[model samples]
Target: MTERRMVAAIDTSLVATAAAAFSVLCASTSFAGVLADSRWVFPALLVVVVVAALGVLGRRLHWPLYATASTQVAGVLVVLSSQFAEHAVLGLLPGPAAISELGELLSGAADVVRTGVPPVPAEPALQALVCLGLGLVAIVVDLVVVGLRSPAVSGLLLLCVFAIPASLSDTMLPWWTFVAGGVGFAVLLASGGQHRRWRRHEDREQVTRALFGPTSTAVAGTAGVIALLTGVVFTGVGTEGRLPGSVPEQFGGTDGIGLQPFTSLRGQLNRDKEVELFRVRGLKEPTYLRALTLRKFDPERGWELEGLTQGVEANAQLPLPEGTDIGEGDAQRVEIQPIGYRDPWLPVFGVPRFLSGMGVNWRYDPASGIVFTQTNQESRPYVQQLVVPKPTPEQLRDARGPMRVAPEYLDTTGIPPQVTDLAQRLTADAGTEFDKAVALNRYFTDPSNGFRYDLQTAPAGGGDALSEFLFRGKRGFCEQYASSMAALLRAVGIPSRVAIGFTAGYRQGDERVITTEDAHAWVEAYFPGWGWQTFDPTPLSDGRSALPQYLNSELHPAQQPSSAPDPAQPSTPPTDGSTPGGGPQDDQGARPAPVDPRETEQSNPWPIAIGVLVLALALLAAPAVVREVRRRQRVRAISGGAAGSAGLAWQEVLDEFRDRGAQPAATDTARQVATKLLEHHALDESGAKAMRALVVAVEREWYSANGRSDESLPETLRTVLDSLRRASPLDLRSRAFPRSVLQLLRPQP
Candidate 1:
């Protein structure tokens, strides 16, 4: 009868543990706001179910805790490996190659974590990560609840799962997640009582009735409601001063839409208004007015502007270019007047030799030829004396090769494999870097490649966006063309960067008027002797595109007429800007020009840091802290003369002995256990006397009818605890992480 009861008790605890773990896993579905869809949730759920099923099977087979845990972990690894990287493994089991492939997927997931915003794409890598993370959590939770019979200790593990989406999301998690967790915790607490009573040989009928009783259900329901309300109040109050806690719900919808420098440009081109931005004077032919240069490229965000690392405050005459040789038709004096335009970057015609009519607030980066100011230049028109390097076709073709430049310009780190392969194949026969660059430009501009200049394609996400644009969609405005060609140039070992500005608008009276519709993005490749030469890959039929004379000489016939858009035609002009309606704009529909993609939206790192810290503390400090708290509560109960005080003190002594590597058998009397501990550690007279006193008090409280509480039990218990601790290792590992506490935190099979 006793053996049967013990078996039954283990089965009851296993069921409770599995139920609690699954409930917490369901609450994790709040990640739907952070991921693109609910597909990831299914994989995470499978992980928890596998762990729970293995636990049941392990109990039936009478396997040790470690064997059960090991089997569950192996099962999870095999399932994920088969699902994600089956080719890498030799058979059903995971090998090093499979692990490496899974690691690469995790690296991809890290990239998405860094560069992507909320509703990030649910790629294979992220799905695998979700599976691995939740699966391990389920294993730890099962061990803590069933192996150690400490269901309350599992709360910390469940909180970590809840924290993932809560920390990453730009909005509040769905309320149902909290409710599910609260109800699960309540069930865990109720079932734990029943498990404990059944193990103590209580009547089976009474234990079952207590667990499933009407009063128990009502109490659990009330506790769950209280927990949910308390959690909401604390969570909302704690993060209120931080970012998303204060952000409105509507703002979160645009988070991971991959806003680029050209999305705004597309919106501007679509607007019906022909708002005049700038009026320019002084050029014999139309040329692009340079505003800002985007030197860094992100596979997801596209070309992004970066802060000026080295530059001087703008003055009358800026330093001249060092290695660039000025061609015959290089120098020109240009005057730019901003009318409706409002931007921080000043638009200049070419390589600036001298700049005037701007204050000290304007700074110029010499290497990039970008002029920026603290405030909008709408009221501050400037003049630039320029040396626009119009290298001839003969000169460009004879240039040695790509020159050594900043690593950022040559960075092709995250470019898609397909893009790199395509670039290599296209440039195979080319002799010089200039020829390779020209081939890439021609590839985009060639109508046979099926590239079209359309502004209607929806934005794409993930690192494969460039591949889609080049081989699949084949249609986008200047943003796609310039960004793709730049990526291609970098892949072929030619240092390349993107320039965002406006093309010289049509002639209006004596001055050329630049409108919001003329915003454009084009590629500039570094040539050995010629410096950075312009390459426009966008196939524009609207006449706003201005190809450099050198590119036209090399890529087109001498008498092609440049295919200018008719002056009378109401054609759409190309623009390179960021997301519209995302920020403040003027009446002309121009938002402040977007900064580098890195600077577009600065996220606060504190929430992520805090979440990480909390998880670490939970893992490293939770066991120690919980153990200390329970010890103090028992000590206080003895001091206050509470009923069952002597039994609580006796339990504390046994726990202390267990922590010090001593285990007393259940059949041993209190005196026998005390005598064995006294002899095993060779305790001094003081420790021996305290152990004898505790043994006496426990026996008196249990066997005597009076059931007297002993006032000296707390001090006696402390004396016995100190003696055991002193004989132990005397290190942080011994005190902070005692074996008794570790059994509750460590994962069992």
Candidate 2:
């Protein structure tokens, strides 16, 4: 009868501990904002109910451990069905529609993980995924901690749950959350050990004594101290400056769906490594290779590529440029041999009239005149028949105004006041829109204006970026020049947009090798009658001198006075002092400056030093702190009551003997432990008598129906504890930092 009752008590304790551990695991989901509002309440409550029910059912039915796992899996499916069933086929189970929705939700979550920097805002799809993941983690933790009875392994699993968000993004979790979870797992381990000890005994009195014994309390106390100290150390070593935070530009590529192209342009321009992107042949002159045009300009959000028209057949011809006549264009055939380049947008020198040797998966957008592939495709050698128009300045100057163009192409909604004023002031001397554009272009390209081209300057501010660039700092790269020029044209009522692509690469033998460093940005002004005309506002002196002769001729005389002698253009000087078209060249291209490592280290060393010192000190003092705390807890239990006082005293004596290397076996009774300690150590007569007396008190407390209480029992135990410490071989270590406390706290299998 007593054995059955003890087993029942052990089962009850395991069930309670499992429930608490599950609750703690669920609570950790709040750190990722999964429970920011009431939306998580239903799922969290369901998890609690399922975990509690499974624990109790498994204990009462004496079912195998596999039964618990099966029930938890069923609970997850039911919960998912109930939450998402409205979108399913039958409205009662997860059908095709529900599965598709789940796939889309997971895909969106993946995108967020790929692109977004946390703290990620809560969306329905992300919230659902987080809740599902949290539920699964909680079930695993419960199985590991309760079913397997390995709290240390469960703690490691819980640590993984906390590490996911921390590793994915740079956001730091709260210290209190770690402490709460750690405490819950520690309590589960302590309860598991106590349960196991109870199962070892058949007498109800022995089981009760084991439940509140010094070993159980010491385990609980030591685990609590270690967990709390760990939390403190983690908090002290804050996560700031430890993580590599996300930069949107670093991941940008050919799709134009992310901020990569816009944001990464600066780094690409500043990179010293020369990586060849592609190569071109059969070109009579160097011209900019147009890739994609950004038309949707929100002053606050910067430039954006709105849409792509996909799935046009390979044989389809591209539409003519908006306001140009194809009959008056010059045709040219160029062979493009791709080096290592792979972008969604194909590079072309002019408007493509015909394409050959390209894959069938390629598509074209007639409006933007860009050819793209649906999926990321490897770059291949292709031939293109392009219509390169040589429109005269007289024709462009006679083209119609903005009234004849599409309204979408002429939007100037968010231009700042300063930008408008500057545009008006710059074009004050010009009458026609073409002349006004020429004037603005002249303003940026003219060297006398003191506009120095630099790639390392700070980025322009949002909405007022043009204003800041033009009126304040005048140093920037091609992106600032192209974007600001586009905004200026829009402000003065000209339809224009920014185009990004590679410039004319250096000529090696007959092939032009285009590298990442040749990536450039320029504006295309829309001429109502003549179509979109390319305008290079970036200065010719800044590694970009290969402009079309027609545009170059128009700006040459207008920029320099006829009375003053023209200064030689500052070009990227080549090793031989000349390039194609008599342009200045650079030696092995312009190499960016090497990065300095000491700059980061020298910025703030004091804070790092202090943090390291504090962490080291805390770690060094942890063992002593835990030992002191366990000693205080044992003292309190001895002074509390007579029913458990003798048991507590006897356990303390055993811990001292165990710490000094005279460990008692699990089946050892109080008298056996006393005899072992006496034989191991050379104790005086008084010490031996005190040890025997403490053993007698413990045995009497265990067997007697009405426990005897004595006021002097606490005093007698203190005397016995001191005598054992003096007789032990490992005296100093036992008195200072007791290893037995750590042994009890170790998770029991």
Best by lDDT: 1
After superposition, the stretches of candidate 2 with alpha carbons farther than 4 Å from their true spots are 1-287, 306-316, 326-344, 373-382, 387-405, 431-435, 442-469, 472-479, 503-520, 528-530, 536-749
Considering only N, C-alpha and C atoms within 3 Å, which residue pairs clash in candidate 1?
65-749, 66-749, 68-749, 69-749, 261-577, 264-578, 265-577, 304-597, 305-596, 519-575
Among these predictions, the greatest TM-score belongs to 2
Per-candidate local distance difference test: 0.67, 0.60
Provide the clash count, candidate 1. Answer: 10
For residue 402, what is the lDDT in candidate 2? 45
lDDT string for model 1 (351-433, tens) is 78788886556777766767766432234677778877767676777877435556677888889888999999999998878
Cα-based RMSD of the predictions, in order? Answer: 19.5, 15.7
Q: In model 1, how large is the Cα lDDT of residue 232?
A: 60
Model 2 lDDT at residue 367:
57
167: Cα error in model 2, Å: 16
